[model samples]
Target: MKKDIILAGVGGQGILTIAAILGQAAIKRGWHLKQAEVHGMSQRGGDVQSHLRLSDQPIWSDLIPFGGADMILSVEPMEALRYLPYLGKEGWIIANRTPFENIAVYPDLEKIYGEITRQPNHVLIDADTIAKDVKANRAMNIVVLGAAIKHIGFSVEEISDAIRDIFNRKGEKVVEDNLRALQAGIEAK
Candidate 1:
């Protein structure tokens, strides 16, 4: 199996964490993984994105060419639109409904949502709200990841194990909270 995913969000949205979890999971499953990160003032709430390619076969490049991404998992809707050119015809866009509103003049959220929903395959979620509801407000990224679980080609249990492994250093509370956040995300879809 092969999956080319683009993870997008503003800085500090845990884009790297999501990539790490997916990378770890892919490694555990004996799959080949390639990732390339693009940072636009990532330390100042600017755009942060990564191209993550996973497959049972070896991947030759870390970059995903235009119109080649199988999925775009974004923590922000507007950021999701920024990578539309990388999405394949059947690619799915799993993104959060919340906007960071970092720009001086942010576009209308309804319009942003409209553009995202216009895609043939998409899952728009209020991941921040879901994360809050799960008592893990900081885990909104994971919530988006959870929402994309079905299309991720990994079982919930497998992903959960990866989460546990990744957050093990943080503490049990974090791991459990993220797990709950993940479940809430899965349920949101």
Candidate 2:
């Protein structure tokens, strides 16, 4: 099986962290992977995106063609919409509802959300709020990652384990908080 996913968010929002955790999980499962990332002006709150392709067989390229992704897992709502051309007809968009408001003239939230929710397959999550709820506000990206649990091929255990492994070096409290944040993401409405 092959899966193409687009990870989107602003700089410093931990979009790369999500990619790293997913990479670790895929590695643990012995999957072949290709990833290409664009970390444009992240320090200036510019757009950040990564194209991640994983397969049971070999993956020849890192880039995913337009309209080929299985899902777009995003930590920012606008960033998710920015990649609509890459999203497949049956693709799922799992995105955070909150706006980062980096630009001077951001679009209206209602219209943006209306367009996003109107997509046949979309799940908008307030990952920041959820992370705060779990007392792991810094893990908002992880919370967004958690929201993609069902959409991705990895088992919940696989994801949870990956999180533990990723955060283990950070110490116990960090591990526990991230775990809770992941759970909150999974259980998000």
Candidate 3:
């Protein structure tokens, strides 16, 4: 089986870190993986995206074709809409309900929320508040990942293991809090 996931956010939002953890988990699960990242002026909060492919077969490219993604994991609402065209009709979207201001005006959150809900497969999480509650607002990406894993065929324990491995040097409490955040996201909806 093959899965294509697109993760999007602005710079410093942990988009690449999220991709790395997912890739590591896929590796631990013994799946062939390929990942590509693009950061458009990421330093100033520009668009940052990662294309991740996990499959039982050998994968050649890290790029995800237009409308070829099975899942879209977005850390910000507007970024989720920006990558909407990449999701096929049957694709699932897991988005954080946070607003990332880029343009002079922010996008309409309620309208975007309504459109995403209409897709039937979309899952929205308040990752920002969740992360803040965990005292790691930066872990919002992991929160989004936790929500996204429900669509993918992975167990929560597997994801927790991956988180442990990824943040092994950050001390036990950090990993534990992240694990809790992940569980909170997974159990949401």
* Best candidate according to TM-score: 1
TM-score of 3: 0.93
1-189, model 2: which lDDT tens digit per residue?
988999998888888788888888999999988888874465467888899998989998789999999999999998899999999999999999989997999999989899899999999999988999889979999898888978886888998888888889999999899889888998898
lDDT of 2 at 50: 91
Candidate 1 per-residue lDDT over residues 41-160, each given as its tens digit:
556778889999999999998899999999999999999999999999999999999999878999999999999999999999999999998899889999999999889788898899
Q: Candidate 3: deviation at residue 5, Å?
A: 0.1
**Candidate 2 colliding pairs:** none
Q: Which stretches of candidate 1 lie over 4 Å from their true place?
A: 39-42
Cα lDDT listed for each candidate: 0.93, 0.89, 0.84
> How many steric overlaps are in each model, in order?
0, 0, 0
lDDT of 2: 0.89
Lowest lDDT 10-mer window, candidate 1?
37-46
* lDDT per residue (tens digit) for residues 17-37 in model 3: 778878888898789999987
Model 3 Cα RMSD, 1 decimal: 1.6
Q: How close is candidate 2 to the true structure, as a TM-score?
A: 0.96
Model 3 ranges with Cα > 4 A deviation: 39-43
Please tell me which model should have the higher TM-score, number 2 or number 3: 2
